[model samples]
Each structure stands twice: as C-alpha cells, then as structure tokens.
Target chain A: MTDINFKKIIRIGLIVYFAAIALFTVGTLSRLKDGSVFGLPKFLVYGAVVLVLTVCVLLYVLHLQKRLKSGKDAFGLRVLRTIHKYRFLIEQLVTRDFKIKYKRSVLGVFWSFLNPLLMMIVQYVVFSYLLNFRGTVEHYALYLLCGIVIWNGFNDCSTQSMRSIIGNAHLITKVYVPKYIYPVTKVLSASINVLLSMVPLLLVTVIYGLIATPKLYLSFAVLLLPLALLLLLVFCIGIGFILSSLMVFFHDIEFLWTVFSTIWMYATPIIYSLEMFESRAPWLITVMQFNPMYHYINFVRSIVLYRTAPTFLEMGITALISFGTFAVGLLIFKKCQDKFVLYL
Target chain B: MNEERKLMISVQDVTMTFRREEDRSGSLKETVTKLLSRKLKFSTFTALHDVSFDVYNGDVLGIIGRNGAGKSTILKIISGIMKPTKGNIIRNGNIVPMLELGSGFDFDLSGRENIFLNGAILGYEKPYLFSKYEEIVDFSELRDFIDVPLRNYSSGMIMRLAFSIAAVVEPEILIVDEILAVGDENFQKKSRARMMELMGGGTTVLFVSHDMNQIREMCNRVIWLDGGTIRMQGETKEVCDAYRI
Candidate 1:
C-alpha cells in the first residue's frame, strides 16, 4: 500500500473508533439516570461499545491490507476476459457445492429450512414453554427467530467463506482465476440457504399477526430489508476476505471463529430483550447500537415489531458501515491472494 | 511449407532455482549450530539456466530432456502456468496446455458437466460448448457414464473423458505434457491419431516428454533442454540422437 492510502485508512479507523466511543459514553450516561453506578446498564453499554470499535478496527486493517498488494487487479483487456472466464467458474463452483452437498439425500434443499426450524423448535420448547420464560411466548419466538436466523446467515456465510479459499487450495494454486472469487462464490451459495431460512420466519410473522402495525406499510423499511441484507452480505464479504487470508498464516482462525461466534450469539439480544436492560442497563443498549449487524437485526426487528423504519440516522450509519466493511474485505482478499501460491 | 516460416513462440534467458541443504559435516554441537544458525548450510540448485528457443507455426517441436532437465518448467512457462525467474515468453496465438490429466474435475460433478466445466476453463463459451458436447462425449466413448459423477469413474475412463474434451477444444497452439504415458496403450495410440488430426488442421504443437522414440516419431523439430538451457535445436533425429545418451 502506498503511504497515502495507508494514512487515509488509518485516519478513517481512528475517527470511527473515537466516534463510536463518544456515542457509547453519551448513551451510557443517558442510561445511568435510572440505576446505580457499575450496574448491569453500565456493563451492557461498555460491552456494546467495545464490539463496535473492534469491528471498525478489523475492517480498517483489511482495507489497508488490500491496498498494499498491486498484482491482483487485471488492467486492460485482461479484465474483461478474466471476468468472462471466472463468472462461469464461480457459477460452476456454486453448482458443485449445491449438487454435492445434498446429493442423494431425501428432502434435499428442504433441509435448509428444516435445520433452522428445528433450532426454533428447541428455542420455543426451552424458553417459551418449558422454562415459562417471563416474556410473551409468541413475541419471544418472533424476536428469537429474527435474531437467530439473521445471525446464522452472517455466521454461516463468514465461516464458509473463510474456509472456501483454503478448502479449494488445490484449485487456487493450479488455476489462474482471481482468489476472491472463491469466497464470493461461497457467500452466494450460503445466500441460497439464507433465503431459504427466511421463509419460515416470514410465515411465522404472518400466522401470528405480529406484523400488525400500520406504519409497517411505509414500505421504505420493507424495501430496506433486502438492501440491508445486501449490505450485510457485503459486510460478510469483507469479514470473509480478512479471515480467509489470516487463516493461511494462522490455522487457528477457523477454530477461534467457532468459539468467538458462540460467545457473540449471547452478546446480541437474541433470547433476551433490549428492554430487560434498557432502564437498568441503558449504556449497554447504546453500545449495541454501534454493532453493524446488531443495528441491521434491530432495523429488521423494528420494521416488523414497531412498524416504523429506523430513523434516517440509523439507516445512514448502517449503510456507511456496510460499505466500509465490503471495501476493506476486497482489499484484504487481494493482498493475501498472491501469498497463497507460495504457501501452497 | 519450406524451412523459412513465422515463429510462433519465443523463450529467452529463463532460469529457475530450488534450494537444498548443504553437505557439511562437523561435531555434534557444530552440526546442530550449523543447522539452526542464521548462517545455515545450504545450496542453490538451478533447474533452468539461460534457456532460449523459438518454434514457428506448423512446427511440431518436441522438447526432449532427462527427468530434472527443466522440460516441464519450459512448458509451464509457455503455458502461463508458472512464471520464469528471468526471461520472457512471447506467443502469437491461443495456447492450450495439457500439463496433467483430469486435474480440473470436481469429484462431485458428473462427467458431462465436467466436460462443460473443463471446456469453460479452456475458454469455451456455453453456446459453443453445448453445440460441440455430443462430439466430445462420443469421442470419449463415455456415453454410458456421461451423467455419472466423476468420482466413480475409473482412471482410464477419466483420462479418456478429459483428453477428449481437450482434443475437441482445439486451440491455435497445443502443448501436451506426458499425459499419454498413464493411459492404456490403446488410448495412447488413439491420442497419436487424434494429435495427427489436430496438426493436420493447422495447429502448432509443442509436445514435451522424456521418450526419445515418441519425440522422433511425432516432431519435425526437436529442442533438447539440459540444465535449463537449450543443448540442441534441429531435426528430430539429430536432437534425439544427442538426447538418447
């Protein structure tokens, strides 16, 4: 990377970190009014702030990395030809994944939906009925379903993409296609599963009459769900690029993600409500607001539950964060792509 | 038709190096230190050194060499699979390199699908491949197993299918590595006949192999590479005679 580009990314990283911290501090103080110092509210706020800052730093590092490597981009006529060639390659790989994964299986693709439904059943059985959870059963199911499904999408896409390049290390070394195409293909493949999982969630919403708010017809938030998902996919793309590249040098990244994701699942308010800690833990809610994925999930939840879209500010932050994540992912993937050949 | 013709491929001053440990003996402590020290014992082995050659269109040039003589490296360099440490490869037409047989198959994909997939990798668009699909399947004699996943195919069956697809996708220049060695003798004979047909259709072929008899029988010109440099470039008999030693 040139000194100028490196400096630009560093400046952006520092600004985001400081901005997130400032917002968390204000949000934390706002929550502190109703509770004692060092209470649950304060911990939640600080925890959420840390999550947002960590994501920002990770993304900026990926961005700086991609900018440093110079050989990846195809310059002139080669670009068009490469696109033409690799498009088929990516398509074929996706088809291979699809065909190979469910080959000779009964229920084939229905299992995509079945897997998430089974998880929902477990959650419903445990939290809603068995434990007699404090929240309303239907509302809890709706909330948990929304968060778990989206989180699964992000988790599956990132983990699969991180391994996509390494798993296809044979092809990457022998063939000349740009390396990013592998992870991009994995994202596309997992998207098929993600789309499948959404069906059950949508059905539950309609059947339960949970989406009854008139503002739900505002259509902007509804329209923004797909847009938001696209951004999130781009966000995963960026994360996938960084993790896959890092996994080459440190084989531990794949294992680390397994543990990290399990912990992250609890950090987001999947089983619990933001309200549980809002008055008692306002700072936590403010900090979670900074997490792009958290914001995305809540944005979807808001449209479904509250019937109104995220405020212009929330939508703006989501867009900016998603775009920045994608840019950085591309940079990291491009930087480490060449080193792959040597390591192999 | 005569001796004077347009050159199709040019290779200049190419070199490749591989590192190996040095043969230095010492006391146990000294040996251990020498192995781990910053100034470690090592040696540089050059696979190819200052190699240069050119082959013209309509010239069936065979590269003859010993096992470690950089023959494969030269072929890989011209095919754009491997970059040379210090040289340039200027080619005039599309190059199709058959470095290894059935290397591109995704075991999950069927034989028919892999034909399309391999064709795409070799630069064939979908429509053209679809049109030529029947011919490839027929030539491979793999019609019965066409829809079966490649993982189930025997080695010979896979080679036949892979070679058939590549043969049908006739590029302007064909570079065949020693894939013919592994297939059955019948398939080898079939491959020779198919190569003859490809050459008859005006494709330039640079066939690389260690077999001197095949080189003499197949190529009009032969370039013997030894220690990464061209030892001789002349008529097949002349070069193969020198390479036979």
Candidate 2:
C-alpha cells in the first residue's frame, strides 16, 4: 500500500477506536444512571466525563493525524515505541533493583511478603488496642492490612522514584536511554513488591473471614482486586513521574516529600474510620473525599472487606483520578525531561 | 566521494549551553534566602557555538580538541544524550555511544550479570548478547571471575568486561570518546585491535581523541574543534598537520 493510504487507514482506525470507547462509556454511564449498576444521584456527571474525554481524544487524534502527514509519529506512539524498544533495559534495571534491595538481607525476597504484614500488626495493636479503634472498624486487621498494602506501594514507588534520576546520575549523564525509564523501573519494582505482599494480604483475609465472621468474607467480588491494584499502580507511576521530574530541579523536594507523604498517609482514612471523623470533624471527611487514595483504599476495602463490588461512582472517581494523574504526570515529565540532564 | 554513500549523521547549527549557579546551594533555606535577597545568580557557558558537520557512511571521522573544546558535547548531542540548546542533529541507523564504558554497571551484580545489564543499556538485544556471551567472556578473559560480584573485580577487570560487552555490538554508527586507553598494556593492545576491527567492518565511526598518532593513523577525515567551533576540517593529514602546528 502507498504511504498516504496507510496513513489514512491508521487515522480511521484511531477514530474508530476512540468512537467505540466513547460509545461504551456512554452506554455504561446511562446504565449507571438508571440505578442498574449502583444507586446514586440522577445527575449525569459520568456522561459529561465521557463526553469531555471523547472530545479530548478526538482533538489529540486530529493532532496526531497532522503529525502523521508530516511523517512523524504521535507523542504517545513515540513514548510507547521507546518503551517497547527498551523493554529489555527496563527489565534489567528492575531486576537490578530487586536484587540490590534484597542483597545481604537474611530473608531476602521474603521481606516483600513480610514487611506489610509486620506493619499491619504494629498498626493493628496501636489502633485496635491502644487507640480504641476496635469497634470503629470491622475486621480491624484486614482493614488495616488493606490500607497499609496500598499506601506502602504508593509510598515506596513515589519516594524511590523521586530519587531514581539523581541516584542513576552516572547512567543518565553517560547514556542516551529514555529519561523516564529510571522512574518507571522504580515503580515497576515497587509494584512487584506490592504483588508479593498481596499474597499475605489475601491469606490474612481468608483466615480472618473464616474465624471472625459467620459467613466467609471472601466473595467472588474479590476477583476485582487486580483491577483495583492496577489502577493504584498506574496512579503511583503517574505520581512517580511528577515527583521524579520535580526532584531533578529541586533537591529540597526529596526531604519535603518524606514529610508530605507521611501527612498524606494520615490524611487518607487508612487507619481511622471515616465515622471517627464524622462526629469530631465533619469537614475533614468532606476534605478526605478529595484524596484519591481515600477512593482507592475504599474501593479495595469494598471488594475485600465488605465483599461487595464498588459503586459506579466509586469506580468512576478512581479511574478518573488515576488516569488524570497519569496524563498530567506524563506531560510534565516529557516537558521537563530534556532539561533534566542539565540539572543532574 | 561515492555518490551513493548515505549521510549517516547530519549535525546542523548545534549549540549547547550550561547554566552554572554562582552559589551552589541545593537546600530550601539557601533558595529562600537567595529568593528574598534577589540574588539568584546564574552564569551561562556556551560549550558549542553553532557547530555543524556531516558524516557519510563508512567514514572514519576523528574529532580532535583540547579539554573543554566541546568534543564530548557534540558527541553527546549526536548520540541524543543531551538536547542541544540550539539547532539539532539527525542520526540515521542504530547509533551506539561508548561515552563511558559500563556507565550502568551495578557493583552488587555479578560479572556475568553486569555483561547482560551493560549490553542492554547500550541498546543491544538480549538474544544477540546471549549468542555473544561466551565471546565476550573469552575476550574479557575474566572466565574465572565471571560469577563474582563486580565489587570484587579489579578496575582493570571491570574495564575489560565493559569493553568486551560494548565491542560485541555491531552498530551502524559508533560514537567513541577517548575510551581507547582501558585496562593494562596487554588488554589495551587487544582493545585497540578490537576497535580497529570494528572500524574496518564498513561502519561509520565518529572518534574523539587527543592522540595525534592514533587520529592520523585511524581517521580518513578529521575535524579540529577549538573553543567550541570547528577551527579546521579536512583530510586527516591536512587537519592533523594544521592542528599539530
């Protein structure tokens, strides 16, 4: 086929792909609005979201077509191509990280499995016994474990990625690999850790469900745990991209982020129940609603602890926050990446 | 001089600038004080000043310059490690830059592992590295220490491993920056021979070196950079003789 014909076909494919997603999103949104999925306000917030997304995607596709005419791939396509091209390098880096992380440690890779469980135990004792958060949350161990696993993944991924650029100054200054690879590998390694930790999380859920509850808390809805975790992983990668880029220019961000993330962890209702804030400070609950982790943690909790699928609104919020952060973070990273070598 | 010879790399009007902070303080307190005092100072150093050059296929081009003459900056620009402050570079084919050998090596990883890791970092496919794995180990002559951690390897041993991993890749365009003098005398001769072999195999080689003898012997064409500008560029004998004087 001629180059023009090939370009035309790809342009059409792009349009069709986006159009299909828009249709699917609209169909799902209408079903959700009819209260078939889950009960909520009749307002068409999701419809508006789908429409805006469709418009944005269409605009981008148009921009991409223009670039195609000029014999250039789209920015997103170039990014994907770079990732595919350097997949081996990324794999090696992640493996290097995993190896170096566990080197000289007695337990080694098992630390990934043990760390969250240990943190949950400490928090469980502190909150359930000392702080009187026992009756406040049902299946307190499971609740605390779920929150810790998700929060730790985000914390480790972001904090480590923040240092990835500077830590690999030798490689960055000497080599021409994609700058995003460092932060991305950090997130991937952290995600692997999260996946390993989930085994223990699930084991605890099963044991706690059988002993503490009349019915098994485990349900078919727990199958959606992967989707929830995938969203959280993408969200952490996005935050990683943002923080890593910011960290390149400002050294203070490294120290500042430590304090900020600790505060952010407490801000999210990880250990405390929202009900605890309902009486003391109702406004805090309203504020916590804006926190993306609050939605993500709640989404995971709804499936694992409550044995119910998340509400359509909850799913929509999590998806929006995750993808939105990812888009923003990618843009910031790409814009600032070329200058990173200078700063480093 | 052949009409069918392709332009392997076209560097046009490329300029690189580095902004150095007068007071190198990275903390928040210093930043805040500087901000309040209104003395946030930056001095810009232009490393390359509108430099332009082109390399054709299978041409052994040597760039000769003193330190701070922007020899490394131009190589970096062509290699895509750093974006030039002005203009651009268009490179065709898979360009392998040996800017610093084993730049991505992990001290905790074994010699065998570093070979693969360093190969991948240099943009070599895993299968190719696998095929050449023994060749690399044999060339580096570190068979006994292949499984030992890199920290345990001597610096010369590390250099041999790095050079071996890098040398195996048959890139269309190879960028070398004064990394020829690696390892002890024996390994150095072996490496130089290996480099000569690579340059002989119809690859477009862009070499930067201060060694007049090496440049005179190896290069078909030479570009002399002085103060970030091409002071002279022509046949190796003409430019090298001029540069020598």
Candidate 3:
C-alpha cells in the first residue's frame, strides 16, 4: 500500500514537471521579441530596486546567522548527528504532513495547481480592471502566473519552515531529530507545490500557442531554482531554529513573522518584474544586485522567459552565496536547538 | 551486590528539576521587570534527586511510586526523550521505549501504515517490520481492520494494536510505561504473558506502574520512588509494601 501511494505521488510529480516544461516553452515563444513583454531593454532602474532588496535580505541573513553561531558547537555537526539519530521521527513527520494535509479533500493535491491558477485569474482581473493596467493580456497573465507560482513556492517554503520546528513543539521537546529536517521538509513540500503549480503555467502557455521548443527542454535549469530556494529555506530554517526555539520561551515571534512575511513579499520581485526599475534606479539596482531572492526570481525568469541557461556568473554567485548561507544557517540552527528543551 | 550480574543500565546520582511560575498576569512591565531583575523568580521543584539504581540483563525491574513520585520521569530520562538536569545515565542496550504507545501515530493513517510508522518510532527498520507484519496483525487480532484508519479504532483496539507491535518486536531493553491499565482483560492476559516472555529472555525490562499486584507478580526487584527520591529499594514485595504505606 505504501509503495503504491509513493509511486502514485512520484508519477504526479513527473506529470507536473512535464506539463510545466511544455507550458514554459509555449509561453516563451509567444512572448519572444513581441512588443508585449513590458518592453524593458535590460531594466536598469529595476536592478537598483532589486539591489536594495538584496542588501536587506543579506543583512537579515547575516544577523540571524550571528545570533545562532553565538551558542555551542558553532559549526553544528552535533545537530546533523541529532538528525541522523532521529531520522525515523523526520520520516514520521513527513508522512504525517502527507496524511493530515490531504485527508477528506476530494481534489487532494490537484488543489496545488488549482490554487495558483485561481490566484492568476483573480490577480489578472484585479490588475486589468481595478488598477487600469494596460499590458498585453497574455503577457500580463503569464508574467503574473510565473511570478506568483515561483513566489508561492518561496512563500510556502519560508512560511511553513518558520513554523516547522515550533509547530512540532510536541515532537521537538519529546523526540530528537536533526532540528533542521522539519524545516527542510516544509521547504520540500512547498517545492513540490511550486512544481505542481507549473501545470497551470503550461496550460495557459498552450492556449497562447507557445508549444515545444529547444528552449523548452533546456528549462531543466528550473530544477536548479530549488537549490537556490533551498539556500533561502536553509537560511530561514536556521533563523527559525533560533527564533522558534526562543519563541518557545518568549511567544512574540508568531505575530512578528506574520508581518515579516508581508514585508518579505514586497521585498522580493514577485508582484512586479525586475525590469520595472532598470533604467531609473541606480542605488536600488545596486542593492537589488545583492538580493539572493532577486537572483532566485531571475533564475526562474532566465529559464522561462529568456529561453537560455542562466549565465555562469549568476549561477556561480547564487551557488556560492546560497551554500554559504545554508551552511551557516544549519550551524546556527544546530547550535541553538539544544537550548529549546532548556527553555521549554 | 552480585558481581556476576553485569549492570545493563545504571542511573547514578540523577537529579531533575522543574521551575514553577508564580504569576499568570499578561504585562509587558512585569516581563520587563523580570528581565531587568535577571531572575525568573522560579521555585524549583525537584522531580528526581540523587536517585541511583541498576538493572541487569533479563531482570524485570519494576518501579512503584505514588502519583507525584517521578516514576515516568525516570522512564523518560532512560528513554532519552528528556534530558536529566544533572547526573549521568549509562544504558548498555538498544532501548525500545513504550513511553506512550500511539503518541506519535497519525490518526488519519490506516492501522497498517501506523504500525510501520510506530514501529520505526520504536527503532525498527521498515523491512524488518514488514517481515513481521503478519505476526503483528495476528497477535493484535485486528487483521480485518488493519487497513482502516486508526482514528476509528476504539481505545481497546488502539491499545491492542499498539501493545502487539511493541511486544512483537523484541528489544534488548524494553521500558513499559503504565500501558496495562487501559487494556481489556483478554489483552491484559496477553500482555502479561508477553511481559513474562520478555523478562524470561535476556531483555532487561524497566516496568513502571502504580499497580502493586502487577509489580509483585512480575518483578524480581523493585524500587519505590517518593517525592523525587527513592524511599525503598529491595525485593519487589518489600518495596511494594513500603510503597503502600
């Protein structure tokens, strides 16, 4: 029974991936060299905006990383040992998340696709009519779709990862697992959801006559997007490990996080294209250049919009920053994890 | 001390304390004051203090304690679920703790799925558990409902299933924490027999319970804990008698 379900879920994941690829191809081809794609030639002002956003994100990551490192085993191999020690518990929570989240829901996981699709339509209507925005309908729709889907992955991962450790306070206090695995699972679940949301992106692209292209298959670089998101997720998890552990003793983080997520949403280039400020904003673009999330979004845009591989420079920078932040985050989270039981 | 009886578990000079908060008022000023004072103003209640004991392989060491006596805390420490505030515990075997059967089981999952899950929680690998699947189902007598989700199971059914899984998987050291009280008479008989089989083998069993009769019947040696201290440690009947008063 378990094997059957596992296979079924994997099949669903594959189908979603395939569908996303086809959709991205069609969408990119249709919008290629068309005057409709917000027509910003290397949006300089937008770079400035993303640069500022990047600096803030980097500062936040560094601040939290410092706080976590101030405790024991600053490198945090001890926490990794703890995770290996309680691998079973992590597996249990993963299965629990699967069962509890999907119980009695008819759409089951199809809601993953349905959710982003519905959001796309609603946003299209609101932006097209309420704001009186005038971009090509297809461009606006596809841009919003791509951004929203990618943001959904990020939002779901970070938001869930923030609560991942705390939400399982019962397990955290009672059972010992690597404190990072819970947050990792939260990120993975959101990643899966993001992957599923690609289905709608595909269906919409097909409607616009953007079918298969050599660039479409090359979209496999999108898989690398998770690696970057994972770094962010790790950064969040590490921060979560310290914050949530502290939150157990002092209970204000939940409320603080709700507001932080809102600010974080605007901080990322999800709602608007990074091209919007390219020519006008210099300092902002410089700051945005440092924003890892900007790179994360651009990573997606490179695959879906630009129809080419992400430049080695972008990939190299993202890889270095992401893995570094991820390692630091893990170290911090592990250093502070043992303090949780004492605080509780 | 019998030198020939090698110690499988040693609880030496263990002390556990918990802080009792005095106020429930919600005030930033109060919190700030507490922070400024750099003192939590907590009155420490010792849950276990200077407690020492040892058990050998194949010994069923029952712990008899009154309601506030820290029996379960001892189990928790031994199980590695909770850390001791001080002292050290050296356990020399694979400890399969039935701290709370079904504690981690997701109610939405089917009985079969939960068995594998709960088995893993108790430290059994998936393939090993799958091999013993038929035996577990047969022992629990829940074959017909194996595929049904656990939330639908009655308390007896839950206990039966949980007990069966724990008992079926033979561990080097088994700590049973007051699970017998919930089982029906038939299950009680089955569990008792299973416990006897485990004790008769090389598995060291640390049984914690309030039932004196069960302790007297099952344990060769007993320790009675009172208010975080062991008041008596000796033969099971002697300790039980001391605990009764």
Candidate 4:
C-alpha cells in the first residue's frame, strides 16, 4: 500500500480515460470557428470521442476490477503484491489442510475420488431403482455425478472456509499475515479435493459411454467446465469470507449454517430433477432458479451431461450470482476483519 | 546504510478494551431470553490505556510488570497480532515475534515439516526458509528428532525448536514474551547468546519478563507497566530498582 504499482491493465485504463478527457478539453478550447466542417461541429466531434472513450474505458475498468474490486487499499495491486509475497504461506496452509484431512485415514486421497463415486453408487440405487423415479433424464449416473461434484466442492469449500479463520486462532494470535489468506487456503484445499474428484467424474462419463460420442468428447463445451469450476471457486471464497467473518461474531452461525446447508441441499435440484418440479410443483421452480448452486450445476450439466453449451442467459445468471456474492463477501470481510482479533 | 539510530517502532496512545458479559447465560437460547427480559449485561476490561513508547534501532528494551500488568498485551500490540482500540503504531522493517514459543506449531506434524510450516506462518518465504533450513535445525540442536512429530518431542525440545526458528532470521525488529523461562539452563544460555547476536546485528528487541535481574542485565532501557499503564520508564537499573521496591 505504501509503494505499490497498479497492475498494467488499470494503469492503462487510467491513462486512456485521461487521454480522452484531454482530447475533450483540447477540442472544447479550440473551437475551429471556421465551420466548414464535415457534417458536425468540432465540439460535437470531441463529445463523440469522449462518449466512446468513456464507454470503452468504463467497460475495461469494470473487467479489470472483477478480480479484487472493493477497496482503494483492499483491492487492486497492493493486495495482489501481499498475496504474491505470502504465496508460500498460503501453499503451506493448503498443504497442511490436505495432509491433516487424510493423515490417519486408511484410504488417504483415494477417498477424494472414491467418496463421490460411492455416493453416486448409493444415490444411483436409491434414486433410480428404489424410487423407480427420474423421469426423462438420460445418463442418470453422469447427471448425478456432475451435480455431486460441483455441490460437494461448494459444500466442502464453504464449510471448511467458514471455520478456517476461527480454527487458526492460535496462529492468528501469534502472527501477522493477511487474515483473508486463511479462507483462501481452505478454498484452495477443498478445491483441490474437488479438482481431484473430477478424475472420477471424467472416468464415470467415459465408462458409461457418455463421452465416447465424438461431438460430446470434442465439443467446446468440454473446455468450459474448468471455467465453471473457477467460477465456483471464486463464489465459495466470497461466501467463505462472509461466513468466517460472521462466525467470529456470532458463534451460532456455524451451527446455524449446518442446518441451513441441509435445507439448501434439499432446495437444490440435486437428487431430484428440476423438470419434475416443473411438471408437478411448479412454484418450487422459482426458488430453484434463485439458488446460485442450481444455476451453476445447471450450467455445468448443460455442458457435460447434455453436450450443449449453456445459453447466454444461463451464463449471465451464473456470473451475476457468483460476482454478486463475491462482492458482498469482500465487503463483509473487509468491514469485519479488523475486529476479528478482538472477537477471537 | 547508516540506519542504525533511526526510530524503529513508535506506539502513540494505544488503548484496548475487551468486553465481557457480566451476567450472561452460556447458551444462545438463555442469552436471548435474558436480553429480551432486560437482564443481560456486560463489563469492559481495559488491557492497555493510552500507553505509548518508542524504540530506536539497535535498542534492547525490557518490559517488566507484575501479573495482569499488561506486559503481554504490550508485546501482542507491538507484534501486530492485536490491534489497539485507539491510537496508531508506526513500525519499520520486518518484525518477528517470539511470543509464547511453540504456540503456532502443529503437534501432529514432524519437527522438520513444522519448521517449514512455522516459517511460513511467520511470513518467511519458502525459498528463504529452505535456504536457512540446515542452519535452523543445527541451531535448535534437536537434529536427531527433526524428523519426529512435535507431539512426541518434549516441551524443552519444542522450545528450542521455536527459539531457533524465530531467532535464526535476523529481522529488523524482534518481540519476545517470557518464552525463555521454560527451557533448560544450557538452552537459555544459548538463546540469550543468540538474542545478543541479533542485537549486535542491529535488531531492535522488545522483551517482557518478570525477572528484574535479567531485565537489568540485558536491556538498555526498561518500561515498567502496571495495571495496564506505564508506571515508570527509564534506563534499565533505574526502573528495575523502582519496581523491585
């Protein structure tokens, strides 16, 4: 913060925006009174340039801002610098979380992949055969697996991250590193588990003859899954910041979240399909649409299971939900973070 | 170049208050009920009150106080672990705190892994820690048990390990809070020598202890904090003798 260089994009945006203003000013002063001009007045020409530049610059700044968007000190170049400086600490934290999780378990990291696979197995039996349900949804295993993959990723990331800051009270009380990095570590650690679980996700798809079709295997939709995953990662980190900071003040948040998440899981169209609700209980479809998790899973399911790219409307909703929660999360964390040591 | 006498840490009118529920029930349900019934109450405990001090580069300062005299609170503030409720602290250069040795070490991790993990927690970059790896282990003198998990290591062993890791890096500022009281005499001598070496290298140290003798021996200046306020501060012997009586 004391001496930081704003990254190239922001610097460039500022420069361009100012350049436009300069052009506008110059145009305003130099009237070019000899009005044998091409269609419009000289001032009008400058105004046009200013308007165009303003639009372009505004869009560019907004895009650059999506990464660390909140504060003069909170976001932008300096925060990135601290993260870069403390990258190793974050790496070690993530490593510790991963190691501790599987430390004494008989099935260490195999459980990462196997847990979802087993859950899918049990879900397949329960949902497909026992209930004799699942109307018109093809590739039920792949469908269920995709939803589990994304939902579990969200579940683990948010759950662990919400508690991550409080869990590391010992370290925080004794050291000075960025507080947000702890939640980031949890996000990355759980994301690693989620990312690793994708192996089985792809395996199940290939095994079930889902991806054997050339168009399904080679479509551009295949590439968008990782982008979808990154969106989920950012979204969860934002929620993590909000929840972890809130939990410090309200110790009940952690327990309340447990109940809320259970309700949220049922609310999401995970085990059941949205089409069923559309056909039977259409009112629940409104709530399903509002659930961020539903939109994200629908986007991914569209790409992976159905082999069709998500529509612009779906993509926009997903991004809006993700970025909306992320911005809210950053605001909450920044506001509450300074008082953390007091509460802790 | 020639920064030896520059002011390193300046604390200006820092005050801290922690709130406690005076007649609160433990359960959220009971707390809510009492709150609705106009019975819930809280009291404020001030740990520090407008306390201010400055330490110059290459200064070895000691903080001596009786129990609950805010000695550790000052250390925590200087270390940047706790923010003051009021006032500001302007600090220069990298700071390393040795407050309560082994407080951050994960007992389940091996000593070697904990070294890296601890170094990371202290904001030491991975490459830098790896470069100082051998020296840290050697200085700890627990080389044989370096591969063993810390839970298996005795308390003294953990202290040595914590001290070695914290002191190995010659930071611009160091804060210690009574961690040397636990280890054996030989280790204590070793740690004191290392701390002196750090001072010789121009690291400003803010140390806290109840031992007046040690304060008089090592510190160039001493601040005696009592009841969350600075009772007296001057040269080492002046304040130590005043507090001892």
What TM-score, computed on C-alpha atoms, does each candidate reach? 0.75, 0.89, 0.76, 0.85
Judge the docking of candidate 4 as incorrect, acceptable, medium or high: medium
Best by TM-score: 2
TM-score order of candidates, top first: 2, 4, 3, 1
C-alpha lDDT (0 to 100) for residue B199 of candidate 1? 58
Candidate 4 Cα lDDT to native: 0.80
Which lDDT tens digits does candidate 2 get at residues A20-132? Answer: 65544443343344542135444455556667977887787678767767878777667545666788899999998989999889999999999999999999999889988
Question: By DockQ, is 1 or 3 better?
Answer: 3
DockQ of 3: 0.30
- True contact recovery of candidate 2: 0.79
True contacts kept of each: 0.23, 0.79, 0.21, 0.68
Weakest 10 consecutive residues, lDDT, candidate 3 chain A? A1-10
| Ranked candidates, highest lDDT first | 2, 4, 1, 3
Where does candidate 1 clash, by residue pair?
A1-A68, A41-A281, A44-A284, A45-A283, A45-A284, A66-A331, B48-B228
Winner by lDDT: 2
Clashing pairs in 4: none
Lowest lDDT block of 10, candidate 2 chain A? A28-37
Model 1 error, position B106 (Å) = 2.9
Could you give the C-alpha RMSD of every candidate to the true structure, in order shown? Answer: 10.8, 4.8, 9.8, 8.7
> After aligning candidate 2 to the native by TM-score, how far in Å is the CA of A293 from where it should be?
1.6
